[model samples]
Target: MLITLGRRYLRPYAPAIGVLLVLQLLQTLASLYLPSLNADIIDDGVVVGDIGFIWRTGGWMLAVSLGQVACAIGAVVLGARAATSFGRDLRHDLFDAVQTFSAREVGQFGAPSLITRTTNDVQQIQMVLLMGFTIMVMAPIMAVGGVIMALRQDVELSALLLVVVPVLAVVMGLLLWRMLPYFRAMQGRIDAINGVLREQITGLRVVRAFVREQREIERFGEANTALFETSLGAGKLMALAFPAVMLVMNASSVAVLWFGAQQIDRGAMQVGSLTAFLSYLMQILMAVMMSTMMVMMVPRAAVAANRVVAVLDTQSSVVEPTTPVPLASVNDGDGPRGVLRFDDVEFRYPGADEPVLAGVAFEAVPGTVTAVIGSTGAGKTTLLGLVPRLFDATGGTVSVDGVDVRSFAQADLASLMGLVPQKAFLFSGTIASNLRYGRPDATDDELWAALEIAQARDFVEELADGLEAPVTQGGTTFSGGQRQRLAIARAVVRRPRIYLFDDSFSALDYATDARLRAALAPRTADATVLVVAQRVATIRDADQILVLEHGRIVGRGTHAELLASNATYQEIVTSQMSLEEAA
Candidate 1:
């Protein structure tokens, strides 16, 4: 998985990677050459009393050392650039893929897990890539070159490498195998911790209201401890690796000295040669150690890479059309430009036995209001979601103007409708920034106009900074009623052909709701409007009202018509108000 991810995203930085490899090669060669030069200096310059040879050899050694430093620095710089670029591209791809997802896909991979994959998982792969480009590329070159050079110093001494190398490899390999499962568990635990933290933070108000702070703290601590345990398990295995490598390395040194002493005393080797041979052996073992470190990172990186790749590979359930029908082309002398229709539409969530909506059909024409009223769990919000393609209908079609929504480009569908979701979510920005989200070019005067219609301009104008006031994430800084009004104002500013308000007035008082709707009517007179509401009074004056029960439309007519004819509609109205108020 790690290799696959690297190959895909790193392919674009091939030239940088090539240069990095070359720099590593040059640096490793210089490092290997130095040990040989030291042997020459000791054997000929020192022993033979040749000062000129010493000076000349020292100069060459200094030059080689400088070149080695230059190459090493160059390799590190290029490696960083390549690795960071790979991370950037991978993160971008993950975010883009997520944006294409329907609600089903987003729910499949919970938000915390998706966040981990995009951030921490991508970071793991990036760190490994950086280490690979720096230390990994040089390890084999140093190992092979050291072996050849060690042989040049003393062939018999080189035999010790056979046992020492294999033993280190076996020990490190076993440790790596043991650590793999722990690394995988650690990633999952991180997701758990993130989930708990996010849930607690977002619902802090609820926690305080219920006085469950201590319980929530314990829950977070339990998740934190689980992550710690998994990390500690991996850390212990990693701790065992270095000591084992050092044991072999120290034992190899003893063997070299023990055997080399015999060769030197018997006139079979020079003192300088024995010394140089040991240096080469240490270089070989060091190279092996470097490679082992990289191997240790592989298992974890591979797990993380698999997670990132999973997100990139999973296609969204709501697929876009290959050849989208243009918005202008779809009008085709339709009933109205903003007309929306649902033809026998039905929707069922994945793995669910019963449908959320069945045999549902309705239409909202331009210059008219269509209101959907239902008891809780009657699929009011779900029905609204289908029109915007948040989830496609399982059977039948949803069309805007005369075109099926699936055939229309996603941007085109979005551009034609202004959706104020049931939950009024706002990004972290100034008031003007959030309001202008739908229409970036809207002027301050236009913004005030929309806010006035939404009954939000009074409070906004009274604020110290008015339009420039700061709004925190999710609009938590504002009261629920304020957030709802701001969201409505934002939608109104877009001036879209069609408007979707999914229980948008639930937070407002009866007076405010009535006033806002009265002001909104004339402003949206030429546009289509769809309102999903639980409150009977909220939709009582609509040109058309549809009462839903058990995912099916049980009644359809004006408030007076439904009151006269439909029992379900009458039941809901009486539950919310007295017969006098209903009249």
Candidate 2:
């Protein structure tokens, strides 16, 4: 999986990779030639007392050492650049793929897992790439060149490499094999830890409210312990590997000395040849160590690569039309803009026993407000989701301005509508920035106007910076009603033809809600409004009221008509208000 991702994402850095390879090659050749030069200086200069030969050879060695340092620096710099860029591209593609995914797809790969794949997983592969360029690229060349240079020193002494090299290889290979499964488990444990931590942080208030702090701590501790055990298992194998390599390396050095001394006494090997041979042997073992280090990182990186690729490969269920009808082109002189229609629309979650929405239908034209009132779990939000293609209808169609919503580009569809979601969320920015989220070019005046209509102008004006006042993540610094009003103001600033408010006014008091609706009437007089509300009072004044029960529209009419004619509507109204007040 690491190789696959590298090939695909690192294609753009081919030139950097080429240059890096050349530098590594030059560096390894320089290192290999140095020991040979040392051997010559000892045999020719020291033995014969030739100072000129020693000076000339030492000069060459110094020059080669400098060149080797230069090349090593160049290779490492290039590798870091290429690897960092590879990670950037991988993260970019992952984010784009996720943007295209529908709610269903996002649900399948939870947000915590997706975040892990994009960040920690990408970092793993990136580190491996960096190490590969610096180490793996040089290992093979150093190992092969060392063997040839050792033979040049003395073929008889080089025979020891047969036993020593194989012993080190077998030991490192066995330890790495044992570490792979633990490495795989470590990545999974990281995801588990991330999920648990994210949940605890997001729900910290709830935890405190219910006094579950100890339980939450225990839950996080369990995840942390699992990660520690997996890491410790891998760490133990890594600890064993280095010692094993050193044991063979040290033992081999002893054997070369013991045997080379006998050969020297018998006049079969010189002191210079024995020294050069030992140098070459150490170089070979060091090359093995470098390769082992790179391989140790590969198992974890390979696991991360698989996770990243899985997200990139999975296609979204909601897709754009091959031949899209432009959102503007459809409404050309065809009655008023902002006509919304739902025709037998139905939605069912995958692997569900029943559909969340079934046989649901409604229409709201320009200058009209259509309100959907439903009990808890009546699928009000699901029905609203179909209009924006957050989830496509399973059985029927939702149209905007006499055209099917699916037939239009998602961006174009979004431009024609503004959605104020059930949970009001704000990015960490100033009030003006959050309001301008849907419309970036919106002026300060426009932001103030939207805030005024949402009954948020007073609070914003009271702040020291007015529209520039800061908003924290999730708008937690603000009260629930304040956040909801800010979100509503954001939608209002867009001036979209169709406005979908999915219980957006629930956080406000009755007086504030009534005042905001009254202010919105004139502003949205020529546009369409769809409100999904649990409170009967919030939607009692709508031009059309649809009461939903168990995934179907059980009643549809004006509030008064429904109160007199529908038992379900009456049951809801009576639960919230006196019969006299409801009338």
Candidate 3:
């Protein structure tokens, strides 16, 4: 997975990667050449007391050292740039893929896990790329060159490499093999911790209301401890690797010296050659150690890469049209441009046995309010979702302006409809910023007009900064009613032709709700309005009302007509208001 992801994202930076490789090669060659020069300096210069030979050879060594340092610096700089660019591109592609996902796809990969994959998982792969470019690229070159150079110095002493290399390789290999599973577990544990933490933070109010502080604390602690234990297990294996490498390295050095001393007495090898051989051996072992370090990181990075690839590979359930119907063409007719029609719409969640909406049909024409009233699980929100193409219907067609929504360009569909979701979420920004989200160029006059229609102008005016009042994430700084009103204002600012309010007024008091709807009615008089509401009073005066039960419309009429003839509508009306109140 890591290799696959790297190939895809890093391919564009091939030029930079090429430069980095050349630099690494030059640096490794310089490193290998230095030890051979030292041997010559020892045997030819110092041993024979040749002053000019020492100075000349010494100058060459200095020049090689300088070249090595220069190449190393250049390689690191290029490697960093390529690695960082690769990470940036990977993140951008991942985010784009996620953006293409429909609500169903997002749900399949829970929010926390998706967040972890985009962030922490990407970071793991990024770190490996950075280190791999810097270290891994040079390890094999150094190892192979060191072996050839060591043979040049003395072939008999080079025999020590056969035993030393294998011992180090076997020891590090076993330890890394054991650590791989723990590394995989560590990423899973991280996802668990992120999930728990996100849930607690998002539901902090509910937790406080239920007095579950201690219980939540314990839950988070369990996830944290699990991560800690997994990391500790991986850490122990990592710790064991360095010591094992050192043990073999030191033992090999001792063997080389001992055997070389015997060979020296027999005139089979020189002291200078022994020293050069040991240096080459150290270089070889260091190269192996570098490779081993990268190997340790590879397992975790591979796991993370798989996760990132999963997100990138999974196709969004809602596929966009290859050739979208133009917005101008859709709205060209003399008929009401905001007309929304659902023709025999049927929707079932993936893998679900029953449909959420089945054989359902309705229309909200321009200059009219069409309300959907239903029991808690009647799929009111899901129905509204189809209008925005948040999730496409499994069967039938939903059209805006007599054009099937699937045929409309995503941006075109979005531009024509304004949706204020059931949950009024606001990003961390000023009130003005949030309101201007849908229409960035909307003027302050337009903003206030929308705020007035939503009945949010007064509270916003009372704030010290008014429209510039700071909003915390999810609008936690504001009350539910305030958030809902602001969300409504945001939609209003867009001035979209079709407005889908998914029980958007549920958070307000009865008086505020009535006043807001009354204020909203005039502003939206020329546009089509679809309201999904639990409160009968909120939609009592709609041009048409649809009462839903078990994913089918049980009744459709004006509020008075439904109240008089529809038992289901009457049950809902009477539950919320008395007969006198209804009258």
Candidate 4:
């Protein structure tokens, strides 16, 4: 998964990657050459008491050292630039994929896990890429070159590597094997922590209203502590790996010097060769250490890569047709004029045992108001969702303007409809910005007109800056009713072919609600209006009403027509208002 994601996002930066590789190669060669030169200075010049040889070799060493530094710096700068850009592009693709998902798909992966994958998971992979480019690319070159140079210096002393290198590899391998599971668990716990934090932040008001701060804190602490424990365990294993490498390295140096001294006393080995042997051994061990460090990062990055892949691999249930039959009429050959039809539509949420909207059929003609009324959990919101392909029906079809919604491109479908959800969400921006969301180029006059119909004009006009009043995130600065009103105005401004009000008027007072509906009646005469309302009075004057109970529509007709024929309608009206009072 890591390799696949890297290829997809990092391929565009080929030039930067090529430059990094070239610089790193030069840097590694210089690094290896310097230690060999140092051994030469110690053995051939100082030991032989040759001043010219010392000065000449010292100058070469200084030049090589400076070249190594420059190449290392250049490699790191270019590698970091490429790696960071790769992470950013990966994040952008993940965000775009998430946005394209339907509500069903979003719920399957969940927001917190997705957030973790996009941020922390991507960071882990990015760190690996940065380190791999800067270090891993050169470690093997140094190791192989060092071993060959050491052999050229003295074959007898080179044997130390065969023993020391194998021991370090085995020990580091054991440690890494034990740490992989812990690293995977740590990523999961990070998701848990993010989930808890996101929930608390989003529902802080509910938490405070119920005064459950202590309980929430304790819940967060448990997740935090679990993550801490796993991290500590992984850290402990990593901590052991470095010291183990050092122990083997130091032990090999001791063995080499001890044996080499005997050979020197017997006049079997030159001082220069003994010095070079130690440098080569150090280089071999350092390369192993670098590679082991890379091993440590692999577990965490692998886990993250899998998560990112899961999101990319998920196919949205609502997919467009390969060969679509385009309809210019919505139903029964009625052409595009905002006519909507639901033909035997049945929808069940993923993993749900039964359908939420079962075999329900309805038609909403242009220039008329259709109300959907039901108690909580009556599939009111789900029904509204289907009209816009927020979730496609499990069976049957929904047509808009004579075309199956699936037949239309996503953008085209969105442009034809305006939806105001039950919970009004406003981004952090000025009132003018939020109002302009539906119609980016809407004039002030058009905005004011929409606001007037939604009953938001008076309050917005009273603000010191009028439409320029700043709205906090989620419209936290506004009251519930105010947010709902602003959202309604936003939808109204679009003047779409079809308008869906998902209990949009629940926040308004009786008088305000009456006036908004009255005002909207004339304005929506050319469009189809679908209102999901909880209050009977809110829909009493609608051209048609569909009353749902437990995901099934039990009554459908005008107010008087249903009252005369439907028992459930009579029961609902009786519960909310006496028949005499209703009359």
- Per-residue CA lDDT of model 2 for 70-187, tens digit only, reads 9999999999999999999999999999999999999999989999999999999999999998888899999999999999888998899999998888888888889889998987
List model 4 lDDT by residue over 184-298, tens digit each: 8988999999999999999999999999999999999999999999999999988888788888888889999998998889998888778778888888888988898898898
**Candidate 1 lDDT tens digits, 1-583:** 8989888998989998998999999999999999889989989999999999999999999999999999999999999999999999999999999999988889999999999999999999999999999889999999999999999999888889888889988888898889888987888999999999999999999999999999999999999999999999999988898889889888999999999999989989987888888888888988888898898888889889989889999988787999999877766564568899999999998789999999999889989999999889999999999988988999999988868999988998899989999999999999999999989999999999999999999999999999999989998989999999999999999999999999999999999999999999998899999999989889999999999998999999999999999999999999999867898
**Order by TM-score, highest first:** 3, 2, 1, 4
User: Candidate 3: which pairs clash?
Assistant: none
Identify the runs in model 4 with alpha carbons over 4 angstroms from their true place: 321-336
Which residue pairs in candidate 4 have backbone atoms (N, alpha carbon, C) closer than 3 angstroms, thus clashing? 329-402, 330-402
Cα RMSD (angstroms) for every candidate in the order listed:
1.4, 1.2, 1.1, 2.2
TM-score of each: 0.98, 0.98, 0.98, 0.95
Q: Is candidate 1 or candidate 4 better by lDDT?
A: 1
lDDT of 4 at 318: 73
State model 3's lDDT: 0.92
lDDT per residue for candidate 3 within 395-452, as digits (tens), equals: 9999887789999888889999899999999999899999999899999999999999
Question: By TM-score, how accurate is candidate 3?
Answer: 0.98
Residue 87 miss distance in model 3 (angstroms):
0.5
Error of 1 at 233 (Å): 1.4
- How many collisions between residues are there in candidate 1? 0
Clashing residue pairs in all predictions, respectively, total 0, 0, 0, 2
Give the C-alpha lDDT of model 2: 0.93
